[model samples]
Target: MSHPQAKVHRMFEFVEAIGTLAFSEMPNEEFLALGMRNYWDGYFAGRAAPLGLAPAEVVHAVFYNFADGEVARHIPWVWGKTTPAEAIAVRERGSAAALRQLIGDLADSPGLVRVADLATRAAVSAPIEGRVLYAGLRALDVPEEPVARIWHAATLLREHRGDGHNAALVAHGIGGTEAHVLFALALGMRAEEFGRVQHLPKAQLAAVVDGLRGRGLVDAAGGFTAAGRETRERIEALTDELAAPAYDVLSADELDELITGLEPIAAAASTVDD
Candidate 1:
C-alpha cells in the first residue's frame, strides 16, 4: 500500500488549484481597483499580507521559487499601494467570489460545510514550527462565511504543505530555479517553454542547467537523467512525510470525504483560464 502520507501529498495539487483562485484567477479589474499595478502586485502583496509588510528578502525566502529581483520589485512598494489589512480582506473577498462563481449554490451544501470543518481542523492542527507562511496565515481569524471559510482553510493547508516542500528542496540541495526546472521537466514541459513562462533569462537558465548536468542530474538534451528523476522523487517523498502530520487529525473516512468533496470544486477551479 502507498504510505498514508503519499495520499496526503496527492491532495496537494487539488487544494492548490482551488486555493490559488484567490489571486491567480482573481478578476483583473478587481485587483486594479485596489490601486495595485497588476496581478503580480496583488499576488505578492496579498499573499504576504499575513506577514505584515515583511521585507522583500523575507518574502523571497518564504516564497522560494520566484526570482529574487521579481520579489524585490513588488514588496514594500505594493504595501504602499494597499495596507496589509486591505490586502487580506480583498484576498478573501476575491477568493470567495471566484469560488461562488465556479461552484454556485454548492458552496453552501452540507458536504462542503463538512469539508470546510474537517479541512479547518487539519489546517489548524498542523504544527507551526518552521512554517513561516502557514504560521502567519494561521494567526488570522477563520472566515465565518461558509465559502470563504473553505477557501481560507484550503489556503492554510496549501501553505503548510508548501513550507514543508521548500524544506525538502533545501535538504536536497535544490535551488529555487533548479526546483522550477525539475518540476517543469517532471510535467513534460520543454525547457524553452518553461523558461518563457518563468521569465528566466536564457543565460541564467543555461547556467542552472549546466550546473545540473555537472551534478549528473540533467542529460545533454536538458532532460532528467535517471539520477535526476530519482532525486526529484526522493524530495517529493520527504515533502510528503513532512506534510503528513497535518492530516493526523482526520479519520480515514473523513480524509476520503474531504478528497471527494474537493474534487468537483478543484475541477471547477481548474477550468478557469490559467
Candidate 2:
C-alpha cells in the first residue's frame, strides 16, 4: 500500500527543493543589485500581487515565518513605491535573472529538465494544491525554461498549502501575533525563542500572551493549555483538509511514485545549506 502521507511528503520536499533555487548558498548579490532597495523588498514585492494583498497585509499575514524585523523594516519601503503588478513583474524578472545567472548551464542540464518535467506533470494533476499557485502562474508574463517551470510549479503547490493554512489559522480565531505565539507554544518552544522569530515587539507579544492566557489557550508560563493544544491540532487538521483536494486528484500509487521521484532532489537541494 502507498503511504498515507505520500502526497504531503511530496509537496513539502518538492517545495524545499524549489526554495533552494532562490535561497541556496549561491550569492544573491547579483539579484539584489537589480535596482531594488534591498533583498526583502525585491523578494516580498514579487509575491505581493499574486497574493492579492497590500504590503502591510502581506507582512501581517506571512512575516511571522521570516525574520523578526522584516515587517517593521521592509514593508514601509516597498509599499507605494511601485504598483502591485509592477512590483510582481520586477520580482519575477529579477528572480529569473538571478536564477539564470546562478544556474548557468545547469538551467538546461538534462537531469534538471527531467526532474522539472516530472514535477510539473504532477503539479498539473493537483487541483486543490495547485489552485492558488496556478493562478499566480497564469498571472506571470515571463517565459518559462525548464528550470523556471520547476521552481514555479513547486512554489505554487507550497503557497497553495500555505494560503490554506493561514486561512485555517484565521478561521480558528488565531490570527496575528497571537497565532505565532500559540503555534510556537504548541511546538514546545519557549516564549523567548518564539519572540525571536515573531515579528511583534516584546510588548505586543507579551500582550498577546496575556490575551491568550485569558482564553485558556496558554498558561502564565507561555505553555499551551489543554484547550490550546486541541485548537492547534484542529487548525493543522483543517489546513490538511483544505490542502487535500489537490492531492486527491492523484491516486495513492501516483503519490507514491511522485514522492519517490522527488526525494533525491530535495535532499540534494538541502545540502546547499544557508
Top lDDT hit: 1
Q: Can you tell me which runs of candidate 2 are displaced by over 4 Å?
A: 1-6, 20-31, 49-114, 122-134, 141-143, 195-199
lDDT of each: 0.84, 0.61
Q: Report the Cα lDDT for residue 265, model 1.
A: 82
Predicted structure 1, TM vs. truth? 0.95
Question: What would the per-residue lDDT of candidate 1 be over residues 115-150, giving only the tens digit for each residue?
Answer: 788878888998999999999999999997878888
Alpha carbon deviation, residue 208, candidate 2 (Å): 1.1
Q: Across residues 31-124, which tens digit of lDDT does each residue of candidate 2 receive?
A: 3554556666666655555655545644554533453455656565655465566665554554445555555566666676665665665555
Q: Given candidate 2, what's the lDDT at residue 209?
A: 83
- TM-scores for every predicted model: 0.95, 0.73
Estimate the Cα RMSD of every predicted model relative to the unseen true structure. 2.0, 4.6
Q: List the residue pairs that clash in candidate 1.
A: none
| Model 1 bad stretches (over 4 Å) | 1-3, 195-198
